[model samples]
Target: MRIIILNNFFSGTAYYCFKFREYRLFWIAAFFSNIGMWSLVYGRLWLMRTLTESEIFLGLVLTANLTPILFFSLFGGILSDKHNRLTILRITRLFFAIFTLITGILIHLDLIEPIYVIALSIITGTLLAIDIPARSAMIARIIPKEHLPNGIILYSIIFGGSAIIGPLIFAPIVSVLSIEYLFYLIGFCYFFTVLILLKMNLRLHISKLEKKISYSRSLIEGFGYIKTQKNILYIIILGVIVGLFSSSFEILLPVFTDEVFLGDSRVYSTILLLLGSGGLVGTVILSISGNHFNKLSVLIFSSICLGLLFVIFSRITNLNIALMIVPFIGLVNVWKGTINTTVIQTLVEENFRGRTMSLQQWSWGSAALGGLFTGFFAESFSSPFTLLISGILIIFFSISIGILLLSLFSKIK
Candidate 1:
């Protein structure tokens, strides 16, 4: 019996890549693309930090990068539902690669300015507003419905794993070469993804009903669908809260590393590596566990863990303790996100998948808001205090919601 169970576990793990061949190609493309995106993000942040050394500037840049999602994700969703998703994906990736290459050349010529970076960020963010939703919606189209949860978990792994690898890969390169070269590398990474996607056979499956609706009308219907679904509504609310309070960690990390830990870029890289490692571990566990557990329960539990761990992470004065705790911080953070995304994807209809996922992307926008607030707050106060206040507020909010969710679950049970 134990042997049979073990065999099933291994088979389930391999099924998505082996049994679903097309999804494997899609997965590989997504992995490299994500890595490239994250490398760009890391290099951009590091460049900003080295140039300005201002917390508020960091916040502003991050906000510029993320704010487009608020304005354009719905449109992206509409396009995804109305047009060929693969084509949209290809166009956005190509655009990003071109932009990144231009920025690299300017930087190499020592002609790059902070304003140029900000402008580039806005352009990249605008493209991402479309790319993210389309890519997410494409998953359901590629993989069978029964295997979607596994596919989603695997996607999370790519995201989390890339977060770990991107920084590590770039940090050393930045140290040895120059920050300008990092931009070139990022461009090449995106180009690599485009090359991979060029060879794959992709088809966009759109329903007749989706084709009939006007873009604006389709967006409204998507919003209307989200309003009617309580589970999805609650999940989005929780995600927004988490994003608003918890997502500032990355924005503040350079400050935290320098001011709090008295460390340099290498230390910053180490902390991120640990955080990413923790996130990767959490994603692996969730992927292996499959759908055996209750997703809502997992979401609630991981959220509370995130709040508590973040609070502890905020107050620590010792570098060793901070390093030790950050992994758990990564773990719970990714765990919460993975479960939240899977639940939303599972509950949403195919017609509304892109829009619903776009709504979900708002959580990142909320985090962008958090970055702005944390930056100004850190500028006014201190990094540690800003983190402490944010963490405490998250704890209060999460615990309150967790109680309500528990009561609702009890009634359901």
Candidate 2:
């Protein structure tokens, strides 16, 4: 009976893989690219901590990394709509690879400094602002509309998997060797992503009317469409709230690890590893059962759970307890993000998908804004206190949103 169950599981997995064969290459590319991105993030944060133990400086680094997403993501959406998304992806990836290589070389020569790291982060952030809209918009092109939710979930799984694997690999390297080597690995991964892109043959089906609209006109139209769609607007607002409160956890993690846990790099990596493990589990669960659940309810419940977890996490002085709570945080994080993305992708029209996703990116950009707030707050008070305040704010906002949603549903009924 156990053998039969194992066989059935393998068969189901194979079938799912076969069904999404059109996205297989993109998935492979995303896996490597995501690993590189995570490695860069881990390395960047570690390096910043080493340079200055100031929470404010760490927050500034994160702000530099995410600021471009706020400014350029909508413009990227305009370009994605106007041009071939595949081409934009390829070009952006190439530029990012080049930038990574240069940074690695500079670090290898012992010429690295905090300002250089901040500058490079800004450049990478700008590239990501362009890359995200194009990459997200391209998913609809490669897969059938009915399979989009699965596709998005699968993509999130790749993301979660990379987050797990990247740190696991880089933690030891950063411990023994140098953070500079991680940059070299990141560059290679980006280059590998370019090769995978070269192998893909995707044809985006854009309407001639879509092609004829000016970029500025397209931007205005996208906003107008979003204004008309209350559901989409609600989701975006939720994203912004989550980004502002929940996402700041990462920016403040180093301080949390150092001051609270009285730990070193290994402990920090362990926390991140646990978080990624939880995210992986969450993604797998979502992939299997997400369609059976209401996406909005998942978002609302997860947000509340995350808020509670953050509050609990803030109070924990024990390393083991803090470690245990982080995985749950990761699980809720992936659940919220996957559901939100699936809903937005499903609701938006094909012509407006890029722009809509760009708006979503802006919601994510709220993390930078949050980092600034958390950084300043951490500098004034403490990391734990900052987290406590963030958690309370999240709980208040989530419950208010839930009540609002309930009222709207009753009125409609």
Candidate 3:
């Protein structure tokens, strides 16, 4: 039974993309690194509480970690276009280890301060801002174009799966050992990522014209490309809408279980488990057969379904009924995300791929900001009502974008 399971795992439906050595190593390297990164997020937030019990400082810690992406991702995008992406990944990831190690050392020495932690967060966040575009740009270079969608779905699986998997694994480590040791473990994970990246032999082409362009011009060109490419622009806008409404609702989950359903912590955990299970099912199905569908049509229909699910989910007064609805929420949401990313990669030019992707890097920050606003509105209008508005807005905008896309393609024809 174990042997059969291992065999199937090694030769799964998405194994076609995994056949490439570059992507395989890249995936393996990124998996540990991303897991560490996600797991350490809790450590950082926890460490902040140790430094200062003030909720304001804790909030600042998170803001410092996320806000840099808003401004620096553009610069990272330019760096991706102008330089060797593999090299950028190497440098940024190396620093990821370095800073992480530095934080651990400070904590161990009893020299850590809230301000110091916040400063390190800014540095780490800035490195991430630079890394994201280069890392994304590297995807096309490593994988075969024919299997790109499957490759992308697999990549998304690692990332999204890590968010749930990482904390669960590392949260226990932080509890069992010291939080400082958790940092050391996370530091080693990143160092291991650097080691794996060094071993991967990847050859990427760099254009001479890309080398000679000014930063100002390269930035301008990225915007110009997206502006002229209506599809890319519309797709990015849709991504923003999804991020703001659907992606950020995890913040409201506790409120849902506590206030709306009058349940306890176990119920909150149950909601999370259901959501994660749904996500797993959705990704598995998509990884196996998502490539057969028309990308744009799948994207539009998924977005609409997701919006409706959000509406239905918000209105659910019964826990069992909400549990059933939650998995479908996870399904169409993943469908929308997977198809959105695949569509962008398929349509974007190599030089613009990094920049085009960088502009979409608002996912984390936008979700954070959207959650705050949603919370504020929920306080006034109730969580259910605010979420209902979110759903309506998403549906309205998804259809609007779909219509714009149809019109644009019609004119192109």
Colliding pairs, model 1:
none
Worst 10 residues of 3 by lDDT: 201-210
Where model 1 places Cα greater than 4 Å from the true spot, the runs are 1-7, 14-18, 204-209, 406-413
Off by over 4 Å in 2: 1-18, 205-209, 406-413
- Tell me the lDDT of candidate 1: 0.83
Best by lDDT: 2
| Ranking 1 against 2 by lDDT, winner | 2
Model 1, residue 177: distance off in Å is 0.5
* TM-score of structure candidate 3: 0.81
Candidate 1 RMSD to the real structure? 2.3
Summarize candidate 1's per-residue lDDT along 234-303 as a digit string, tens digits: 7888888888888678888888888889988788888888988899999888877876778887888888
Residue 7 displacement (Å), model 2? 11
Location of the lowest summed lDDT over 10 successive residues in candidate 1: 201-210
lDDT of each: 0.83, 0.84, 0.76
- Where model 3 places Cα greater than 4 Å from the true spot, the runs are 1-13, 40-64, 98-121, 174-185, 205-209, 254-273, 316-323, 363-365, 378-386, 410-413
Model 3, 1-413: lDDT tens digits are 99788667645556567778889989988888877786566567667755664444544565677667878899998998888787888888889888888888998899999999889988998998999888877888887777776788888777557655654554455556666777887788888998899987645535334577899999999999999988788888878777777643564565677677887544654565566557667777778774566778878888888888888888889999998998777777777887788888888987788898888776554554565566567666777887788888889988988888767767877
Judged by lDDT against the true structure, how good is candidate 2? 0.84
Model 2: per-residue lDDT, tens digit, 1-413?
Answer: 99888767644431254345558988899899989888887778888898888888788787888889999999988887778888888898898889888888988898888899889989999998999998998888887777777778878998789879977877787788877888888999999999999888746534323577788899899899999877788788887887788766898888888888998888888898898999999999888774777777888898888888999999999998888799999999898888889889988998888889999987677788887998899999989999998998888888778667656545755
